[model samples]
Target: MGYYTQAARDVWTLLIELQPQTGDSGGGISRDEYISQVARDIQSKLPEVFDLDVIRKKLGLEISPTSVVLLQELERFNKLTLRMIRSLAELQRALAGEVGMSSELDEVARALFNGQIPVIWRKLAPDTLKSLGNWMIHFKRRHEQYSSWVDEGEPCVMWLSGLHIPESYLTALVQATCRKNGWPLDHSTLYTQVTHYRSEDEVKERPGQGCFVSGLYLEGADWDIEKGCLVRSKPRVLVSQLPILKIIPIEARRLKLQNTLRTPVYTTSMRRNAMGVGLVFEADLFTTKHISHWVLQGVMYGGRAIDSFDRRILTVYMDEYLGDFIFDTFQPFHFFHSDSGGGISRDEYISQVARDIQSKLPEVFDLDVIHKKWGLEISPTSVYCYESWNALTNSPSG
Candidate 1:
């Protein structure tokens, strides 16, 4: 069998075993039992000799343990899993109706219940953690990102979306620049300069100043490669992938703004409602258009799928869309397969849904009615329903 095939099978089996159930009878288990199963799985994955320092000393390689990527990655994974095990244990205890539950534990439980990923220290986006299939996909993406970094070794262009704490990396970049140039760390601040490279592979070397980062999605605007500046999004494109970005540390005193828009960067499309979430940073994007153009469009950068448009339309006009729906009355099986005897791809499905919603909207409400009744002012000419739907459902990494 192929390597990834075997890995997928292993994870699929674990997910089946991790299914949440209630009572002590049949092939069922409670939520705490599910947590216990995950804890045990994590324990099994951990190595007995995960401490690299001790391993290095014991192996008589203390002078230089090589600092291999595999070794470092293993150690990092071990630490992460160890913390997860501990947190899962605490959560399991709290699930048993135990008294005196800490606020953190309460938050964790609520996050899990609401289908959101939960970090012991902070809240993650509603990434469908309660849905094991979705969680598996999320886990695979994170693992792939980490493996890519490990294989590449201190990437020239980092994938910002793959990080759990992107601010930490951003801060570290400033710190490294400050330390290298002997500048006071406190006096340094970050300034982003967007590059023209479409992909990370195009970046051959690191900049002398800070770092190059990728995997940030731009909403409500697009970067014109030839012009090297922000422009209005394409006719049918709602979110556009930003090219490699040069994030440099500058002396706070020297920092100046000219013809740039201070764009907010959010961790996820859910915006502020997600736990422990807000604008992670404000990037100064080069723009020829007036800043108000983007501000009026609610333009921003996001870590993952940019779903603000989706939420506004989907949640508010849900009744209207559902009422006029001509498609098959939602069946789980129909989702994966098309009635035309061909399997529907994920993008195809998203497009189909978006088009269906788009077709129905004008029949029921025009731009004026929509804006007046719902207080949501969408562009009258905007026909990027596909992009909006993709942002809400299946935005592939950029």
Candidate 2:
């Protein structure tokens, strides 16, 4: 007999023994009587580990595990008989090229040495695990041509996340490589796909055409254009078809202040500065009329009249204290009164302006060196104040 046929017969024998049996009071056991008897036996053994599903699958039976089966006077030995049947089936597969080391197989042998068989076996059913393991091993050893099937230009798509390389650099590199290889290059035909990373649970979709391509992903990092060095350890690649987005550089103005007063006094001043011309608001701030005016002055060097109280407070604090005294205490305080010509205390105004500025621009006022820089009369501050006031006055609605 063929090795496979012998294995199959062994498995079948084991299954037959596990089948439940029934007998009539008469000498001969009838099929219907046997089935009824087995059914009752199964019901009595309900909720036991001797599951019918496991038994059926092991025997390679066409019937469902839940289906009723008849056996003649052998119902009690079902579990033991089934196990024996499955073992013999496995032994047969092991002997044939269906399992184990076979000189005729190549792929199966490689798989066995590579430790993949154990992994597959662990996931398989108890009855099929051993045979499946041997089969895979045998197939690998006997099939040389089968192993190369994967190398036949099967399209492999890889998704990269956390890529930090710029799109331009990658596109340029690809273009350069194509030129060096004498490949026909189409710059206009470049296409890319992009997925924005938001959170761990968020799934990034594949990029479609017209998206940007940032860099060729190698290993876990984005490769540099010149030397192909990975810039970072994490595997991430940006795909964009458009020229890479350029980061706009911002120049921050630093001001130094000196405290000339024996007792530091609060000063207020209106700052009309156009500092945030190109910058967009990172977050929205809900300010009173006064605070809003100051914020606008800081951003556009102008005031919006939506909130007048906010504007008034901003104007008083910025012009008197922040722009003048706090910014440059060395310059003598020239104060004006509400009624017209009266000198106000530089110390009081400076303190008030400082407090106001702090409340409005908490981030800006949190600097340790601000006190030192505050006394330096810088051109930027002056320019900011001038622009703010001019913007306020020139407004048609103002």
Candidate 3:
């Protein structure tokens, strides 16, 4: 009823039904971990019990049985049922990897547990089979868009990778973005094109000074309030003409660390029911100065904010409780893994990042020549050296 599949909803009902949740159960385990418990007990063990009292006390069930089972038949199921339970748990674990992907999990469950397909698929709809097949369709297309941008040398980076808008709304937006960014995808991880984009329509200089995501994110341009199309305009700038982000810092604008995370953030391209068909048009409703402490780091490690917008996406907590559940179940997490390359030494990479920064924000004696690129009015100073932007902004004239 809430933003989940019927089966997923049942899993919630069943957990409370099977055992009153202790704080440990609620706080410690994730949805995937909790699902393992459901597969083991409620899925494999619940059906084995025929005793009315056992069902009532253990499973919290009150269903009346239609027929009585003989002792021999009951004995057959009662024996080695633990093995079956263990096996089901293993299956759920195997499925966990596939299901960890927010968009793909539903299709994985639907395929692996589709009753006839894997024989393991049971009538355990109560355990939340979660055949939200449509969600996967949506993300794959979004993934295509992601692959295109990241390959085209302009990765569609985001800071809060945890944000998963309600499935319906995300799908709608993904649909729109895919059409807009119809560039081809290149999956090779060997090399990435780090071009500079001045705006959505302007991408000049291949292997440009820095990587920039074209088009600033319109502060509140994209949304879904009671069913409407998404709106994307230029992201709000800190200054009138400058593209400096009010939300994200200048250092973060550097392309190198654009998608870097402080936590083991989940990153995946997912969508919901994308036939690659038509667009959903929504009504347009129109709608912070803060220097980030990490600006110097961003200048050194981050790319130029030549054209990119903030990677923050706002979500409406439809219900605080359900909203948390939606994020947990839909966002796929990945471990951080990077190996040192033989060609590009760490120092070399850092140097390249610095060079890229220099290229984008070259020095000019006259602020009147500013149309060339954005730079501090003071001196030809590398942003990496300036610890505080306040010091730079408060040049002698100010």
Candidate 4:
């Protein structure tokens, strides 16, 4: 079947299985009762789809002990599914008036519907889901890439962003490099080199030294295709698509940092909660000027692709001067219809976001700090600000 056909079938099966039974359907069940029944069904059946026993057997083909990392990631996925089930049950109870709804539970439901990994599972910074349809595409592509790696063995060029646990893949690369060179694995670190090819399909074979990886994005900066170096971000362009890169293991001391920015790379665009886990590694990007220039511009790298709106928000957050007035005039979006009672006040919303941002980066400043740093806060108020924010946050992206 075609990709869309298969996806539609899958989603249709899920909806049919989870559909509510009304009085006309012979169950005579209320909405709350239907939700409770669906929750129980999810708890029972969803986990079977994520069973790792079968996956473990497939990965066991690689007899190397390094396979443990991949196994652990599979285990993590199973655990996350369990957590999702429990959260759903909580939501069902809240809907039945047995308990109160919470922000966390609401977030879990949103993540599930949008086909994005929940923050509780990934422990990464919370991000805009954009739209259900857009994220489903990313989710499907991720699974396709992962299944190809598992079924066909390692590929000549890998889509690095597709893995559930990218750190495991990087570790495997390091181990293979060390074994090939007869070097101590503990003494080596990852090193990245940009390739001339802009796409993964251009490379037909695996490299002798390291693996070729694709699917990385440059935030707050752009890559100069001709110069093959870091450059200022194009006006109104939020992110730059990076070319294929080769990652190899090298001696720690052998690594050079002179005239290079040790750019921290994340698995996603949201970097706040990704310090230890979601942060894959640091890649050195060649720069002509001082490193502070990149830092002030908030130049960074991420593995996954974000929609245009997310790119715009990242730019606004990074460079206050770009959209001070626009950002100041905006309002927070209310996602839940039944729960949007008066909604959160603008100041309260800012404080909540500041707390979240501060928890991730204690040393840096918060959103309010952006206004102070730029000394620019224009309020071109709009009557439709709230509606505009909601539309931007939830609209489907291409």
Candidate 5:
């Protein structure tokens, strides 16, 4: 076995029994504190022979000394495992020159390494993270412009939650890469399949081989988890395989977006089609008055997610979009209102108009625009006031 795990009962037992009982156990809390201090005192009584300074200078690890019997047993098993792997590789490589060597090598390699890695971290590339951040900055600024048609009333926030494994997290990463770097094939296509093939590891109704695999194999990318083969046996993809998907470069390079370097993995994900559906929400026949026509096209910018296993990466991107959506949603067109000819004051109305112009049309952010366009010759405090006022009952008509 590559790794060992204690049974649930054994683990629970360990959790309950932390410390051993000793003689002279009286005043419980005071006794416990004294015991901890005494333990520390005992620990501090290290022999002068093993100086930490010298140890650090000479040692790479804090290895404990072992008896002859245990040392021999450990060394014996380690050598046996090492020899087993070397022998397995040799067997596979010897069969390399034969036909279908990739398949054979895959079989042997799986029989060897799957036992080694029992836990998968499911880590993301550092470059992917950086690119995603940059893409978000760009998306938010662009969405603000998209929000031009809507009124800024509330925050556009969407609540999403889920777990992301290795295979499916690719979709959001690819979409961010595309939108920021500007790729083709439409936004939704980022989650769709580019190239796919069925290997022996798949568990499905139609166990098609190679490119002749079933529709699901071509549906989207997968992480090749430990649960493949319908028997809960081993991971699907082998280390030797070059994976499966290959990107069409001419089409990928068609757009030539600026600042492509910001998102390093954008092209890589596109090439390998590492992307897929991240998250989705649905309502039974939910209709909105704003949408006039529903045209079903190839791939839409914000249509629907085809592969939503969890809330994972969807919210990371959608948070910004939804934020802008909510900000723009439910806004009254005639929001900037005040009593005419001063029941309250002429100054308050001018300030209201100034704020309306500032938020509604941010292009006129300049103080000069405030002075010129709205004709509001007021203090700078008028530029950004969040408060709304009630029109006074009494009117002062000139």
Candidate 6:
């Protein structure tokens, strides 16, 4: 049968089997009452479906002859499902304001989803029920995690604004680098002691700045050919050092905006330069320069670098000017301006920039891929794609 037809049959079967009794309760079941009763029945039957033996043996656990859970419990006992569920549960509990952590429960969930628990637990062991109870508890926690991540939206701050490394590989890289450099590494210790440097001024003021630093200022370290190994630096260092992380490959794309449009001539910086005269003419006559500025800025921040002259112009525009003139002059075609002429608010702007970078940049930053290749889990969050923007924003050190 086709997927939709099969799905329809299954859903209809479930509704029929779990439908509310019609003999009592004001003669016939109201729609709302029927739905409520069906939900309650489903909840009651969940334990039977989650039975250990049934899951281990991969038996189809159906509520009725025609309907079964869409996904098999044992089949989803892998890393991706586990991580997704864990993230979901954690967020849910956090939003609920419940102190809902349980290490024992977590262990049982890991055993079940990771396929660590024995097959015999399905039938012979009393601990099987206990394991199921633990599974429920952990399942709740995972739900909380997922909910929290979703409500907050995209991660608090991506490592280098969506540099595409999974959290696991990033963590492992950090750990390995620390170990190599003889720097101490522990999640709790690092959490409390971390600091972020946004500019050279901060780095100068605090030269001993350790790992947890983030944002646009500090660059990563790289191998110095003359020094024979990786040596750390700033500004330029960030891009250079990325290759050493071995998370993702960085590639550069080049484009010329001037060729795309045609316009009249005006004045030129060099009186004899035709190209210069053409550009100046376009800028003066049609306000092309203003629109060009916004488009170029969008492209640059979106992770593509312009030519030398274009890059210089963009740097001046982004750094020298402090207001929304770039956005304003561009008007209706404000490519980078996300929030209309009222002006893109800070949060909105940041989110837009981050999303653009993430989408445009290559996925070389995934820590999980790095770890699987190198046998390490560098970042605590590396096993999954989700990151906590709240954690990053609330971090005192950053």
Best by lDDT: 4
State the displacement of the C-alpha of residue 109, model 2, in Å, after optimal TM-score superposition.
3.9
Taking all chains together, each candidate's TM-score versus the true structure is: 0.49, 0.16, 0.18, 0.53, 0.16, 0.15
Better of 1 and 2 by TM-score: 1
Residue 182 Cα positional deviation in candidate 6, in Å, after optimal superposition: 18
Q: Write the per-residue lDDT of candidate 6 for residues 1-398, one digit (tens) a residue.
A: 12244366558656644544333345376533433343343244332113335432443442321012112222232333444344434533532456464564343333333223323233221122223345445444433433332344222222321121223323444454455456555521111112223332343321222222232221122334332332334443323321111121111122123312222211211111323321211111112334444344322122243233544565555544434565445444323433444567768878887999989875335544555785654566643333554355458973
Off by over 4 Å in 2: 1-102, 116-188, 191-195, 198-217, 220-398
What tens digits encode model 5's per-residue C-alpha lDDT throughout 1-398? Answer: 11111244346445534433333345555433443343333234311221334323443463322112222322333343344344344444444433344554443333222211111111211112122224334323323422321233111210011111222223333444455456652523321211234342332222121111111211111223232211111254211221222221123334343211111122111112224332221111111211111111101113343222222244334343233343234443332223453465558778888998878863323444445765647555554431111122223541
Worst 10 residues of 6 by lDDT: 243-252
Can you list the residue pairs that collide in candidate 5? 156-322, 156-323, 156-326, 162-311, 170-275, 171-275, 171-276
Candidate 4 stretches with Cα past 4 Å from truth are 1-51, 58-62, 78-132, 273-277, 300-398
Q: Measured by TM-score, how close is model 3 to the native structure?
A: 0.18
Q: Tens digit of lDDT per residue, candidate 2, span 1-398?
A: 12244467568656654544333424476543433343343334322224445444544654321122211101222343343334334433543447763342332222332323333233231122234335434323322211221233111122111111123223443444454445445532222222333222343332221222221212112323343222332333321121121111111122121221111001111211244222211211122223322232332223353233454466566565344333323344344433222355656767778999878862323333543565566578755865666676579975
* Native-to-model Cα distance after best TM-score fit, residue 100 in candidate 1, in Å: 22
* Local error of candidate 6 at residue 293 (angstroms): 64
lDDT of each: 0.61, 0.32, 0.31, 0.62, 0.29, 0.34
Tens digits of per-residue lDDT, candidate 1, 266-358, equal 776445554546556778798776554454455743343245444344333433333323222322222132322346666787889899998
Q: Please provide, for model 4 over 1-398, each residue's C-alpha lDDT reduced to its tens digit, 9 standing for 90 to 100.
A: 12234366569757754654333334676544554565565455443334567767876665553356556655665565566667877887777778887988655554453344556745521233334345435545654654565567667787777666677778887887788788898899988877788987788888887788888888778888778788998887867888888887787878876667778877765553624555778877787755545654667433332333444454544444333322233344232332223576657766888999978963533435544664555445532544455566567870
Q: How many pairs in model 5 have backbone atoms within 3 A of each other, for residues 3 or more apart or on separate chains, i.e. clashes? A: 7
Model 3 stretches astray by more than 4 angstroms:
1-131, 142-207, 214-398
